[model samples]
Target: MKIFDTLNTFMLEKVKPLAFRFENQPHIVAIKNGFIVLLPFLIIGSFMMILLIPPYPEDTTSGFGQAWLALAKELSEPLWRVFQMSFNAISLFACASISFYLAKEYKITPLHTAVLSMMAFLLLCMPYQNSSADITYFGGKGLFVAIFIAFYVTELKRFILRCNLSIKMPKEIPVAVAQSFNTLIPILAVLLTIYPFALLIEHYFQASVPVVFEQFLAPVVQASDSLYTLLILTALIHLLWFFGINGALIFIQLWTPFLLVNLGENLKAFQAGEPLPFVITNGFWDFYVTHGGSGGLISLCILLVLFSKSKLCKNIGRVGIVPVCFSIAEPIIYGLPILLNPIFLVPLLLAPLVNGALAYFAHSLELVPAMVILVPWTTPAPIGAYIASGGSVSAAVLSVLLIILDALIYYPFFRLYDKICQEKEANGKEITQ
Candidate 1:
């Protein structure tokens, strides 16, 4: 208890403040909002991709699967194009959104800044080789570079504005017109700066901007393949939640690019009928590690409804059960008030790691294949697992097994908390009597 008390003090007094600061940082805030804005497109794209894929892995172009493949192609080909158009253009959208949001924070001309920044990004990606645009860089492969340009272009615009390089119009002119003119110099400056550098790299190094930048980010992307790294990140996420912070916002930055790259690779390999190349990905996190929402809130909610003696726990859990089935856990987090609650602290922090470790080992042993499809986070656990692993019953079974184990891990702590709550209620009743 003393150790728990000390740790709690450290978390509240030190960790909480740091988490809040990170959450409030300008760039972090922009990235978080930008990702939120991009999520609908990614979700739509993932759905379309799933539609294009045959549910059974054994289904191929020949034999009994032929008719199914033809039907799938007919239904999903056009939609697949739609998916490609959106998901492959993530870098373009990421640059625009990040610039737009960051510019908003800076009290600048957001639309103009966004456009300018996007233009800067295009300039960096210049000199397309093929008759059709070389779109490889427009996808997840180019996200790191997109982030760089978003900040660089916006900052350059800020610098230009600060230096009074932008046009200053007469006081009587319309504010809109004045603002438009004011953006001109900044836009030109961004283009001039980025275009030449891009040209120089192309001429001298014989590599595109994205190619050059990808090398720099390769290490960061490679780190996610490590189980220890994944576990640490998993732990950090629930730790933040325990302190009442939205962990997803902070950790998604670490998860998104690596997951995106792995998903892209998996999609390519799956199309070629090759085995998946990576075991860890965003899909693994979604469908395996943190299934039933962060910290196994699904298990906690079930226990609350079925076993809790407290009226408050039972009511919250009963209402929360359906949401938890779909991997939504905010109701339990706040309604049952897991955040900042000492009884929940250990289980909340430990549950994700326990789940992640078992899942990682299962994957390492090839007991379950790497998930190719990026299933929606809200999908039910077994169904999501089945789809994500591309029709693996073993994977779905693993999901159920994990839930049971998570429930076990959480049960004792919940019982203890429930007992304490019951005692408090009894004391109150005695006093009233």
Candidate 2:
């Protein structure tokens, strides 16, 4: 046991510095910086205007006729198809760029390396006319592996830098201060670049998970007709988000098959000449629309209100408001200091669970409708929430209520964050001005 312990400690000491160096290396630094610069374009181009996709009609005959409605269909169809291709291409480019930068670190030719990367990306985007299921599975897995490899290659360069480099401090500078700055800059740059891309990739691919999650939740949703079950599901989702796991992954793992089962049931009911209790009144509109799921606007509003004091945090909060309302909270989560802040840990977990519970109750009581429509997650808060719930005004109202609840939850943590910022500002003023 003593020998084992000694070896473990020895290994940790060796690995720690290597890990730190890998995170701070130059090629990694360049890729990270580039990723940050490209993130906004990638996110906006991919997610924006999704709500505009038209929904299918209730009647098959009407839908068929609408498809043939030449002038109107021609106008929208080409534009929508263009937007879809453009967004997908942009995502491919972003991932490809990361791969190229990483390849440069290995003394490999960056420009030439991109050919392989782009080929990998093309494979992901290409249509498999014969088998969509097989295509989706293989394409998604391949893309993920490719991206991971790119990151690994970049980190390897950083490792090389750490081995060959050493910093020298100026005579006038304090050794501790110089050392700290040397240690911090590279790591910060890499983090700023890679983390945001991670968030974007996770979010973009998340679209497919719900089809699975809804399936898993169906039997549970149908079992007792008890609102509590929905609350449980909502809480489970919140818990998953808290740990920094992709919330969509949790939903997909638990529910996609069940959702398929429900979908099959709905089709069977339709074939039996019975009116389905809920028809997917509009697939495009419904699938694309999303807002914080059961958590609603409350989660974002709370974060915004709490972070209002710091110039940076306030700016992030304000900028994030529109996205958060629509259920896209990546900006707020990453931009604010919430990632490591102890103060935020509580509300971040609790607020969503509470909001999810309330939403479940309201939905179960028929005060709000179930989300029968698919809509983009980037739709503004109450509006997206309202539309997803089949255009129910009550669901919009509930969304508003949840926003208020979120504000309440975020209040205390925001105060703590504000206090820290204020202290830092005061210290800066004293030192510089």
Candidate 3:
């Protein structure tokens, strides 16, 4: 009880304010919004990836699976093309999207700013010789570079505007030409500042900007993939949620780059028929650890709907059932008013932690393939599991298993909470609103 009191004090006095500021910070906001704009493109690429390797096993006897595999083989070239253009160009899209949103946030010209960001990104990451350079940096590997470029361009533009650093054409010059002159300073600034670093890195280290960044950050990336890291992240997000903060979205900002890079690596290995190089990815977090939303709220909704005796409890469950199926947690969190609710706290922290451990070990032991495809988080967990696993029956079954386990974890907690609701209802305190 004393520990809870101490924690409650610390959360309210310390972590809560920091979480709110982080959730609302402009750069972080831009990052979240930027990713939203590109979700459809990633989904399309992942769909193509799944088609490249038929979900059915290589030894499958299913007639439909065999026919599909044949068709996939026939269209392999086209499939690879689409996948390469979209998913493989993740960092490029990320640079553009983040810069565009950040520019808008600062009341600048978003379209032109986004283009400038890409221009700088390419100058550093691309090889000098036209045909010799592989596009290794254009994908998830270049993500950090893309982020830096996005910030650099937008902030540079902001500084130029602040210092009145544009080339002003005479009044008689064409309006379009005058607008074009505005971009000259940023372009030159890019060449003068970032271009030198790119050249130096190449000349001395024989590496591109993205490569150096990836190498510098490599150890951190590898560490983030472990079960311990996953559990800590899971706990942090759920803990914040218990106090009425948007912990999931907040953590997503920090985790997205790592998740995207891992997903890219896995995609490459899967395409080459090599072992998947990662155990952590968007699919792992979305479908396995946080299925039905963070903290396994989907499991709680099922318990509320099927078993609660309280009318208010059952109705709340009915309302939340659909959203949680799609991996949204708002309906249950707000409806059940789980925020600051002591009875629900233990299950809130424990369920997803259990799920994360299960998923990490399951994939580690090779009971199922590590996820290659990056399915949308909103996809129902069971369906996302099968698709993300490239049709692994065991992975699909594992998803169901996790959800059941989550429900079992919540069963006693939900029963205790529901009894209170039942008693309150008898006293005409039926928990409405």
Candidate 4:
């Protein structure tokens, strides 16, 4: 009891303060919201994955599989063009979207900053060949470069404003026209600075900016898809949630680019009919570790509804069960108040780590294929896993199995907490009577 209280105090005193600071920090806030703002672009572009690749093996014995494959082959070029326009050309939107949200966070001119960010991004990352820009880096491979430009260029623009490096218009000019004119110096600065550096990299290194930067981050990128890294990140996110911090959003700010890179590499492999090179991705994290939101709260909701003796627990379970089925956790988290409650802590923290181990091994052994599609996080876990794994039944089965296991993990703790609540409620009733 003493140890638990001490640990709880430390979390409130030390961890909470740091986490709150990061949450309120403008750049961090923007990155989180920027990803939220960019979801439409990601979802629409990622849906092209379904169209570009048929979900059947080449040598499948089923007639439907064979016919589908034939149709896909016949329509390959048009499908490829559709995909090429969306997912294949994703970085263009990613850079602009993140910059726009980030500019709003800074209370600066969003349109001009977004436009400038895109120009800077294109100048550095895109490569010209045969009178057309190469589209290879525009998807997942280019995401790392896009996010960097989004942050760095936005900050650079802020720095320019801070130093008053932007052009000043005549007093008689309208403010909108004046702000538009103010973008002139930042434009030249981007041209003078970013363009020259890109030219140097091109001439000296024989590579586009994205490729060069990816090479530098190759080690970190490769390590990010490992099982150990997945478990560590999962634990971090849950731990933050345990303290009532928005751990998933906070961690997503750092983890988003890596997850997208993994997603991109997996999509590439799926389209090329090769073994998937990444087992960790946005889909994997969404469906496996966080299927019912942090701490397997959906499972808790189920247990509370079915088995709890306490009225409060039963009410929370009834209200929370539906939203959690779709992966929302707020009602359960705040209502049951999982934060700092030692009774519920272990099950909440441990279930996802357990899921990560089993899921990683299952993927490695090819019991289920690595997810190739970026299914929305809000989609039901089993269904989302099915879609994300390119329509694999086994992925859906794995999600169900994990959910059941999570329910088992939370059961004992749920009972313990319910008994306590039941006692408290009984005491209150007697006093009132």
Candidate 5:
């Protein structure tokens, strides 16, 4: 026990400095900021995924299957056909943003720089028109190259400005030579090392993993008919989001098969008047499909209360409310200090689990109908929950109650965050004065 405790302390001590360093680093800071700014794109991507991926049905032979399947097929067919183009567009946007940022660092005309960046992005993303293979060799590989070039150009300009380097033809030769060398070496290395490997992995994984996960993991999760698996998966989803992976991606990837297999069991249990899944039974809202979120009104209210206190908190809180209402919390989760705050992290992670479990319990007891309808995740909280649960106003009210509960859960942590911010501000004032 003493050894274990000592090891734990040592680990904590090691982690703190690294965490602080990461939080302070400019690149890390930029990525976090960029992520918040780019979140709407991610949300858009998730919606596209949902529209493109066919939802699994409970019955395959029925007339509903024919109708629903036809609908699903029609929506998905065009998306799948044009998926490469869509992916290229997304990559180009990311590259463009990186270029714009790099240009700003060099004190250049960002508009001109961005246009150049976009051109490079397009060049990198354009599909080879002459290729005979069924799959177009999209130059998705060039995205990083574009970003690297942008950064290199920005840095070179900075260096030249600082040193007052001559731009005459003779002097420009050496600068151009140096820039060429800088760009070529990394570009070649990436092409030789990373590009082939990335392509290989992408192809291999694309061929195998989705099918395996669907056939294997889906059934195992569904077979148990236990709420614990769902809880674990939801927790995993939250953990992934914490690491900057979109939570919706995780949900959409695993949800169809998992939902198809288990939802039927859950609904059967609900109809038979037996114990329902633990999430709906215990929590006021079901997160997976019923509501875009778990804590419902409780969590929202808690955040609102927190927002009312501090300027930064208030601003982020206000901005995040609309997204949160639709079960999207990326803005709040990242924008707020909740990511690193020990006080907030506890509830940030646990509150959802608690809510899921409660919702499961409530659902099992037939206190609420098993959620059957598919609603968009971006729909507002109570309204979304109501519509998703077959227009249950009671469910909407419960969602409101859950949001209030979340507020209570979040209050103490918010106070802690507020205090920390206040102290930091005070210290800044002292230094300034």
Candidate 6:
């Protein structure tokens, strides 16, 4: 108890401030908000993917399921085109979203800046002439380049706006028209700035901006695919949560682009009926690596409800269990006070790391197919795994196994926390009596 108290004090005194700043930093905030804007596109596109690629086998014996599969196959091409228009054009959205957020940060007219940024992104990444090209560059594969172009165009717009490089209109003019007039200079400035550079690069190197970034960031991208990187990132995410920051936000900023790129490739490969290519993807994290939300907090809830001696602990668990089942851990994280409570820190941080390691090996060993589909994060475990793995019972079984492992890991710490709560309750009652 003394050690737990000391560690809690140390964390509050030393770690909290750093976590706060890291989460609140301007660029970090912009990136996080930008991803939030992209979340809808990802989710809607995932539903389209599920519609196109049902969980059951494409070839099945006579049954309703078989008929549904046939219908899905018939509709698959149109659904694929829908998915392609949205998911495959994700880079375009990234440019607009990032610029929208950054414009808010810079106090500029968001719509104009966003549109201009999207234009700049297309100008930089797309080919000039009529020719065939790999379209993946316009999707997740081009996210890093899209992000860079967004920032570049937004900063340039900020400078131009500050310089008052605009046609001043009479106050009698309609505000919307005047604002459109005001955007002219910044729009032209961003285009002039990006378009020539893109042409120069294409002229000299015969590659688009996305291609250049892909080549330059290849090593980083490769590193992101490693198991060690996954462990480190997972650990970092949980660590931030220990200090009360939204760890998922940090994870999204640093990791989601890579995860989405892998997901995009997996989707294409899966549609081609080829063996799944990437071991790690968005679904890998959502369904495999962290069961019951970040750090497997659902396991802690289960332990509390089943074994806690303290009435307070049991009640909190009862209230939190429903949400936890759907991978929403906020109730347990804050209500159970796991935020800076050192008693639960080890399990909170360790469980997710263990989950990631296990999931990584499971994939590397060919125990299950790569998760090609995206399941909503709100989807409950085991079931979510089943869907994400395209109806693989093995993946669902693995999720249940991991949940049991998480419960085991959290059991001892939960008991200790329960004992402390019981002691406090007993002491308070005695004083009252």
lDDT of 6 by residue, 1-433 (tens): 7876787677677777766777777667777888778777777777688788776765667597787788787898888788887878888898889889888988888888899888887777766556754566677788988888888888888888788788999989999999899988887887777878887877888877777788888888778889999988888788878877777776667787788788877888887888876888877787767777788988888998989888889998999999989888888888888887777789988998888899889988999788877777789888888887777899998888898999999988888888888898988752110
Give per-residue CA lDDT, model 2, range 240-298, as digits (tens): 44434344444432332233233223333433445434322222111211244323433
Q: What's model 2's overall lDDT?
A: 0.48
- In model 1, which range of ten residues has the least summed lDDT? 424-433
Taking the tens digit of each residue's C-alpha lDDT, what string does model 1 give over 316-381? Answer: 899999998998888888878897787888998788888888998998898998887777779988
lDDT of 5 by residue, 1-433 (tens): 5764564455457744555564545433333343344336533443344444334354667785567667757777665444434432434554456556655645544444455545543433343356633222121223234444445434444454466553334555676454444343333433454345434644777532223334445455544345676677667555544444444343433343234234333433433457544232111224432243433323643465455555666776777766666666666666763443345546656767766666666666666666543344566767766655544666677666655666677677667776666666656642110
Clashes of each: 0, 23, 0, 0, 35, 0
TM-score of each: 0.90, 0.43, 0.94, 0.93, 0.44, 0.92
Candidate 5 stretches greater than 4 Å from native = 1-221, 243-248, 261-307, 429-433
For candidate 5, give the lDDT of residue 176.
47
lDDT of each: 0.81, 0.48, 0.89, 0.84, 0.49, 0.81
Highest-TM-score candidate? 3
Q: Which structure is stronger by TM-score: 1 or 5?
A: 1
Q: What is the C-alpha RMSD of each candidate to the true structure, in Å?
A: 3.2, 15.8, 2.1, 2.6, 12.6, 2.8
lDDT of 3 by residue, 1-433 (tens): 7887798889999988998888888799889999888888898998999888886777899999999989999999999899888999899999999999999999878888999998988887777586586677888889989998999889989999889899888999997778678988987887798889888887888877788898999998898798888988899899999988788889978898888899889989988889998999999999989999978899999999999998888999999999999998888888897877889999999999999998899888898888888888899999998989888888889999999999999999999999999999989874742
Model 1, CA-based lDDT: 0.81
Q: What is the lDDT of residue 281 in candidate 1?
A: 77
Off by over 4 Å in 6: 1-15, 55-59, 131-135, 429-433
TM-score of 2: 0.43
Candidates arranged by TM-score, highest first: 3, 4, 6, 1, 5, 2
Instruction: Give per-residue lDDT, candidate 2, residue 153.
Output: 38
Which one wins by TM-score: 4 or 6? 4
Error of 2 at 335 (Å): 1.8
